[model samples]
Target: MMSNRWLILADDLTGAADCAIAFGRRGLAAAVTWDVTTSGDVSPDDSRPLPVLAYDADSRGLSASDAAERHRGLLERWLEPDRVLFKKIDSTLRGQPAAETAATMAYLMERTGAAFGICAPAFPATGRTTLAGHVHVAGRPLEDAEVWRRDHTYASANLGFVLGTAEIETTLVPLSAIRSSDLASRLARIAEGGPGVAICDAETDGDLARIAAASLAVAPVPFFIGSAGLAHALADTLAPAPTGAVHIPPSRSGSLIVVGSLAAASRAAMRRLAAQDHVVHLPVSPDTLLGDLAGRADLAARVAAVIAAGDDALVEIAIGDALDMSLGPRLARALAEALDPIATRIGAVAATGGETAAALLARFGIDGIRLVDEIEPGVSLGLTLGRLSIPVATKAGAFGDAESLIRISERLRAVRTQGSFS
Candidate 1:
């Protein structure tokens, strides 16, 4: 059960980075892939010694069937004899967790003759916890959160009900049992009992630690299914020791901030970051970027010029009074395109939102990223793979506090002054 190889699959870039950071924090070399098409070009042996490979399936916006199929294919291609499988679900359950988990279960059963999956999506550090089989955010039901309220497909926050719809059998491990001395034996029994998913309840890091311990103690190591929280617990118990302090040399120039998420938190953070005297705020509207090619070019030039002048630039998608969900993806791609002209000039790229980060990095031909640090509970900082070696920071659209953007900007600046990404 104690192995360094891990195939961590996530639905998007942010999810991939957050989960991978759990291992990186433990001193294990972890990388989050951006493009799956070129995944074959890199082998597990080709990466860092005993590396943790995290792939972004990019299936968040796909249909349940498509997402499931995508994960199935990934498992077929990447799952190896010695590698452990970790399916990273969104902490807030934003993606098709039940369908994808079922897909993972099917593949694991076929490949390893395993029949059970240990499901624990609680990320206590970010206010996401599970209790009595339901997922809660900040003490409220997940569906009650702004993200789910705006766009949700699940009938309820109950993990059992959600997975039941996908025909994936599940069992709940309550907190009471988790805190008890018999917890380890209970989990071992569950593993030996049958093939199904175990939905574990956890309100704190301690609960997750117990679940992880019990999992490893079992005969057949169950497939792990959860967010960064579970990953953290597993990393602490299973991953190798750190090589050294996690450090990335600072950027030589000012950093670039791209905000394309429509989440209220992102919008508010941009406002606060834009007001900083040292920050140069360049707002890009979706309409102009989509329709006005010349104007888009002009904006890109200005953003590049500002960075060249050693001034940090905040290039954000302009959101109007009316709420238009359709504009989100388009604006994300547009903003990324506009910044393509100055990708190299950017000392570091700090993006908010998975779509935005993916679009922007793909433009620069970045195929993957090596995670090295965690800026906060939900924010991960790393260096881009392939041609670009610059430090990069990624945050989920709805994650982080009001000053998250500010904190990223400051971190990048500190690195810039430090000389090099270690």
Candidate 2:
């Protein structure tokens, strides 16, 4: 019952919501819930559209069985094909409650027979709202300001659990890493300088009012919710600004880094283009950010130590295609081809045009084996010779597990737009 279709069970409500938004964008009707307090409810149709549901903030702390039963009711209500049912839970190996979250997952998976995946995103030694919230990202002279930044806002690192009765397996790798160029570019574009608008949870209805206010505050170019779906929704909900386009007015944004998954990064970049006509080819990755054994000590640990100390660092690594290309290429191409074998293939010679992506390359494969003599599939390398210049977060493109790629991509795009560093 659970092996055929794709079932996605998000570890946390936000993960569920975000994954649903991803589905909605693909034209599939989906719903997401954050409040997990009580089990029985149609879920909130406000923060999200009908196809996209959000849990009431108050209903987020229910017993696992109770929550699971309620979710069953919700799914029974939405008995439509191509419809998604999500339950996000946090796990505690040491405790039963979090494990109860896992119980909720087990129930949804067995009952719905939906194909899904799970993601748990947590920042152990990081600061502020480790997961989801406003992050006052500053670089260089702002080390002392992180305290200020945290005071001003926080982020949510609540576990992202995505599960469905689908074939997609959940393999989450904690890769809180990104390229420098990617990070720097991200900050610049997002702030766009001056008091820009901040759109919170635009994936839901109440968020619309929030955006309206944000628009009023920022005027015209409202800073939209970070994810692509919310951005699209905001653009649709608001009257086309005088920028002349149905989209947010184009910005003379400096540069932006497209991090995370290539597909997500590419979509984020494409969505934010005020000047869509202007061809902007952001660099993408087909590897891990903190994957495999090498990443832990290789890049992640090194960067974590630096940033924790309030120092800056930046690391660069080369990426290419497989079959005479690079390993990331081989893995990316394999996965993409599996998703859709009809994808076009580039020759062994030149770069695959200016714009390269993780997803598109995933048409090939994403798993590369590492051989000391030769860096092949399933292999990663690290070099830490550079000065601790800027508090840097370096990760191989393939570091994060499968489903997390989307969120990772969103984060990368956000950081890139913020242009915090360069």
Candidate 3:
């Protein structure tokens, strides 16, 4: 059977999500994934998913050769090391910038069969920026253009696409090709959207929390925003909720849970909401954070611990980063009383300060991590272990994520429904 998986070469995580939205518009369930390189700061109790992943400068793999090796390993784990796609945006820069992008593209395409789509005018509507900071297929270069087109406006704008890009195929949304939109309509659609899941991966808490609230406007499902940075951004809004807080009513879809951040007050409030409806352990408490992790410091230590513990042959062993105080190791130690060696890969989604996260993961000696291009800079939407083979993950406290957190809840629900794993 042909694989239905769709991969995108986006400028950033937001770009990845936008592309996923495009895929969703084209009638497909899409998830914008990122790899975590930092330490843990998010958690999930009875609700939420762990965020994505990232690797900051502190990682031992920061060296050119090490980074390349890391990417190669990841590529081997996922797509072919050489057959991945390269998506480029258009802008203006000098010599080496363009040369490097082209060289990288050429290397991937030539050695890996990954041809690229150079978008001259980077995405206009969104804030996606060109990495090389230059233009591609700009100006009069549209002589052979097909799917690509011109962009009207952007920070650095222009437009073009590959000659015959396929549906969901790799395409560049240069700063130029981005289309503008009305804030009102966008908010309305998001608010009125059906009950699924509302995810916020913005760089700051204010912007992301605002958007997260908007997603909850008309939808009755659980609302989850990745990354504490974004969560704190909207802390005020989420705390009192202007559009109104829809308490976790029994009639609603899923319970509300905020993982990934130690914004103590906010996490407490969310749990209180869930408690009102008697929803099973959502809105997790900071006190439950077993490790005595007081934010960044705690997370860093967890990363070091994860590295030292090693993946070994244990199946689970909390297969993730250690968020909160109740680390995967401690949890594992406790589980040994009755459980088998199946590690759960826990506490993998932590999005504290970039540098701090870096320190933690770095100390962990996780020699195989690398940063994803889109989730690198400019665009935000921080999620820990957001995308990877990690089977389980959670935010530190009430900082909720979509994929990993939901998976945990759903699995538990299923286990209860079917006889008893308990």
State the C-alpha lDDT per candidate. 0.83, 0.27, 0.27
Off by over 4 Å in 3: 1-5, 8-25, 28-68, 76-258, 262-276, 279-422
Candidate 2: tens digits of C-alpha lDDT, residues 1-422? 11011123432222233333333333333333222332222322123224333332212234445654554554454424443333332211111223333344444446544222222211111111112322211212212342222221112222222221221222221222111223223333433442221112212323332332333322122111122222223324333212111111211222212232222222333344322322233322334332433432344344334323422222222233222223433443333333232211111000111112223322233211110110111111111011111111122222223333223223323333342211
| C-alpha lDDT of candidate 3 relative to the true structure | 0.27
The model with the greatest lDDT is 1
Best by TM-score: 1
| Residue 224 lDDT in candidate 1 | 89
Off by over 4 Å in 2: 1-49, 55-57, 86-104, 112-115, 120-170, 176-422
Q: Write the per-residue lDDT of candidate 1 for residues 1-422, one digit (tens) a residue.
A: 45777889899899899988888887777888856565533443375454578888988888999999999988888777777789988877777888898898887777778768889999998889999989999999998898887777688989999889899988889989989999888887788777888889999999999988888877666788898899989888964674655455555577889887778888999999999977999987777888999989999888888788778889878877575776777777787777787787888889988988998898887888878788987799887887677888999988877899999998878766785445
Off by over 4 Å in 1: 37-50, 239-251, 320-322
Candidate 3 lDDT tens digits, 1-422: 11223333322222233233322222222233334432222221213221222212121213334433444443334333322122212222111122223333344444535332222223322232222222222222222221123111122312112211111122232222122233223444543432211111222223333343443333222122122222222222322212211111111122112233233322333334333322333212233333433532433333334423431111112222235432432332332221111212322222222222332222333222211112212222212232222211122221222233334344323322332222
Clashes of each: 9, 116, 81
